[model samples]
Target: MAKAEFDTPQLKGIPVIPHLQPGAMAHSRPFVAKAEHQEPLGFPGELVDDWKTKAIDKMGELLTKYRALPVFLDACVKCGACTDKCHYYLGTADPKNMPVARQDLLRKVYRRYFTFAGKHFPKLVGAVELSEEVIEDWYRYYHQCSECRRCSVYCPYGIDTAEITMAGREILAHIGIGQKYSNEIIGKVHKIGNNLGLPRPALEDTLEGLEEEVEEDLGVKIRYPVDEKGADVLLVTPSADFFAEPHVDGLIGYGKVFHQAGISWTLSSYASEAANFGIFIGNYENMQKVAMRIRQAALDLGVKRIVVGECGHAWRVAYSFWNTLIGPFDFLDPKYPVPQHVCEFTYDLLQKGALKLDKAANDDKVVTFHDSCNVSRGSRMGDFPGGQFVIPREIIKASCNHYVDMAAETIHENTFCCGGGGGLLTDDLTELRVKGAVPRMEALKRVIDEDGVTHMAAICAICKSQFTKVLPFFGMGMDMIISVHQLVGDALVLGAEH
Candidate 1:
């Protein structure tokens, strides 16, 4: 059996600039997808013999299709503004993990084939051919990126490394090279309506179990309705919430809010998943396919509105891309945006004094918030531009008596990824995931040491799961990372007079 060797670095309570170490993580490649995983997503079963030509041709096509790709490739002057902006670079000290260097991996290939100067004098422009080593580098480094877009925030040219990373992964997939975790899950969503491959019966059973538990604990009947055609709102959430701890608690919180609001909401077993892996791999068609399920469900169920749950990247796709990908959404009730985030819905009710909350229920623990990367950077909430950051914290403050924030830099748009994002959360990439979490864990330690913050709440399922798995390695309890709605569920007073 082959084992991954990780040189875990010690946390220093601050982000340090390490001496450049090339090839430090060049060998940290994820598992390649099998025939079954590739074929269903309309990719080749294995690496084709003409992979080099196919890869370059695919890159050219992507460059022309997405204006951001070509513009980003041509715009970067290599001024080094974003060199230290990436969490992976800060954690691993690998130069390749730097956003500029990572972009160059694909940029070099683009210049070599597409540019005039590169065809004549490739060396002068730092251009390289599409060789086997470059292909391997693409697999290793591109997967290392969470496509979180944190680097773009600091780039003087506004060069989005995430665009480059997504283009690179798309080209790789076009050439029959795909990451097992993401592609496999994409297949599951296509076949079974979720990343978990959960059938409708299993989902119904889980929701029934949750209803039973809530009734037993609170003496209240909170409904977890599924496939209820006449419901007013269709709730779409990540499949993890159907079974996973903390995530399920968040679902319970959402149910409690809907119950208290006296609004009818139902979960669509046909489109049960909110986490869309399609965006991770940069496949627009597949992404649209995953998103269209929700649109179809809404039309079929005759729901007046659609509301999304706590999943972060799913919220990004829903808020930013759904209208473009599967819209005009003319069939949905025109009063609300075609789809609204659950946080927005909950926060609006809080502002209107519609639901009663008991903040003292959370008085025993001091809490902090981890802004999941996609929510912080790629998407917005409410009517404001930075509502993505404000709404979640506002809800938390309303729910919990004691609330603190992580370091100012690590909390809002500058938030680091939980290290297991972008479909790299599988066991095969465990070493990379743990090492990547160092920067986040360091920020967390500061609050724990100074403010005695006992828990960190997040809106993303991946963030909650990642922190739970990695916090124990940092001398913290796995239970410290929790769902934001878990706090709401705790503090919520069901059936209270408004």
Candidate 2:
């Protein structure tokens, strides 16, 4: 294989977030507010009283069932083995951070409402009656932690807090308390086929602009084709990648690699977003819709392979859940079968000696890779060809000379979340977001201050966005964050050499 040509697009301004730009020159609209209507899926104003009542009853019913799940019941041993492992508890010294305590917020109710001991003799199991105050407490504490799986690593039973968190969100969504930021984005993906809701016209315009930029910057003519028939790969990514800082640069890198490799790939204006927020809400139907867009795009394009972009949850949904949710497409080419992650794609190229890499490209940068919770721990689908999340380390180590670990407690399965996992990456929740992120930010600060690690490489858009915000709060600067693909781009010895 050969090096792919890259199309460099002129980035006009950072998307959505104006504060990301420097000085007084940058202008961004206020973050979109929460849902205004009471409709379970729409604005609160359109919600009729009866509809609201039904939605409330439905939510209560779902919460009632989830509270009685076998995993929730049989998993806890009350061993207190998972105590010291919590990131938030370690950081804030809050007793609520303990895995047992966190689950007890729901589990206590579970025992009370459903268990044999509670029904027969309430006081025996420490089971209490559920009330409005109990619901309020669940709402508060479940949202307090970032749903990072640090505790699961130490849990003897592997009772994941993230699972509990998702369950809580489902209960919330049932009750109509779902956040507009993510829920609306999911709705947008369904309505317009992309989360940012960019239509085909704007998408075509962005691609054309990228083509022209490639010609200007790299003296290469690269094509970002949409709806092209019989392409080899259909590239799926988070919509934020199109306009966000550092992420768009990864797109440029993707174009470069594919162009150099002489691969036939196209971006789809339809099903453009890789994010599947339906997973957050536990709405299997919506999850299928999101994944179906990709499969439909692939089938329609006649592509042999689908290459997922760097977004973590997108890949989590695609690689982990797509096969089960919206699959059995035996028509796809069996040789290079199924959707492949960009990391897997690039890593294979390097492994096969197809693309030349300039190891010296990242030579003096002390970089660390953040294993996103969704991609690493949350994934039940097992690893890509190379390994689970370790491929990132292999790729990073291959490209950069100085690689350092961020304390033993926060790597691989034990890694701390960027505090923005699970659809909470909105700007409106700044204070709570920052507080929940205290553990990870403090760990990063320690590594930056002690180990002299300058840059952090993360694959998820949420992680990137969250770090871009929280890193500054800890008095760090912006240049420290980069996508894993950006590092790959720097290392790739392009056909049109730098």
Candidate 3:
């Protein structure tokens, strides 16, 4: 026999026993297979009987709730026109990753169990009855998706897979497999009024810490107040910003901008976290509970406007749900309304040339942007200026002299995911995480090898963390990831040091 690739492979050390057999992997076997039908994709032993019953019922309820919406009922055409647009499908060549296939994971069940067409003739509509296997598939595939909405950008009908993912997550929660990272954050925010569960004292400490760090870094006596009354702006950021890498830099950037702008802003020790996990769970009550604090904080402080920091999902929630959930933020300028995203806010400043930048500050490196899915695809705010998703390009251009594009095909709406979105930014799903990351890494690596990209600037928190973890697998470096604000902060030419 030919020698193995490795002269001394690690397996070579273990003696082979005649009776020994390789056992099946944990996720290899069907979790719930029928006599004839293949089971859905999911981890074995995760789908318990009691959980299945509750999950089925919850799925039924979601069909009822979602079907009632005009956007759902009137919007979908089932033409399969947009099926080829899914990044996961394109990347992995997995048929189920197709947008149509992914939606059908739930839509088929909805039609079979609830819709009139399925009740009349299920076979005609391809609506099959839900099985234990189907639930397993739901848990597996649905969780595989980041619900990034990148697919929706190319969809002619504008049917968002994110909506389907949300519906599926609601069902998962009923089955008790809801990931602890997001769900637990929601619970903490609901009880303690922040996702970090930073009570009054802890929050005060963080603010003080930020102040000390800011003073040390910039050599300025900057103030970071918790609940200063009658502030001009209420600055809200994700909890990760306070505790994580690159994100903390974004928070510091906000401070420097506010200092220069002569703006009065305060963080609410009450509602510190900008991320609202209610979006993840489809729990409107919890969503409202978590979001109410922002409005209340504004009311209490008598702030004029709420300026959300560099978070994608938080901006989506703030834009889509905040108005309906807790409103008449009528107190905000009528022209601007309740809340505005930091990118848009910063872009506006750049347009007016309000903030000064020294290109030499960022001249040391070449920067290209990763258009965050939630920011570019969800917001539809790219029409502002410069044709492309102007925010990223403009920010990079303004802050640095050496900014470049990631080839035309990969820039703007066609950009790939960092693979840790839709709350998959957890530590457990290592295998799936790397698998999901291949497409993005491939794209970045090509550009890095050919065009000489020195840094990959992005706006989302999960993208930063995910890229940091997975980039090395593709021969990229951890130092490659930097937030948009960090570049801005670095480039700022302060008039006079405080």
Best by lDDT: 1
Return the lDDT, model 2, position 296: 83
Please provide, for model 3 over 366-432, each residue's C-alpha lDDT reduced to its tens digit, 9 standing for 90 to 100. 8888887776666644345333387657877889988777656566777666777776776665544
Model 1 scores a TM of: 0.98
User: For candidate 3, what is the TM-score?
Assistant: 0.84
Put the candidates in lDDT order, highest first. Answer: 1, 3, 2
Measured against the true structure, the TM-scores of the candidates, in listed sequence, are 0.98, 0.84, 0.84
Q: What ranges in model 3 sit over 4 Å off?
A: 1-60, 67-84, 90-93, 175-177, 335-337, 380-388, 496-498
- Report the lDDT tens digits of candidate 2 across residue range 363-476: 868898778877777663224442656677777888778888776666777777776777667665454455455656666777777779999988888888888887776667
Question: Cα deviation of 184 in candidate 2 (Å)?
Answer: 1.1
Q: Cα lDDT for residue 380, model 3?
A: 44
| Model 1 residue pairs with clashes | none
Please give me the total number of clashing residue pairs in predicted model 1: 0
Model 3 pairs in collision: 41-137
- Residue 268, candidate 1: C-alpha displacement in angstroms: 0.6
Off by over 4 Å in 1: none
lDDT of model 2 at position 371:
80
Using TM-score, give the best candidate's number.
Answer: 1
Output the lDDT of residue 244, model 2: 88
Give the TM-score ranking, best first.
1, 2, 3
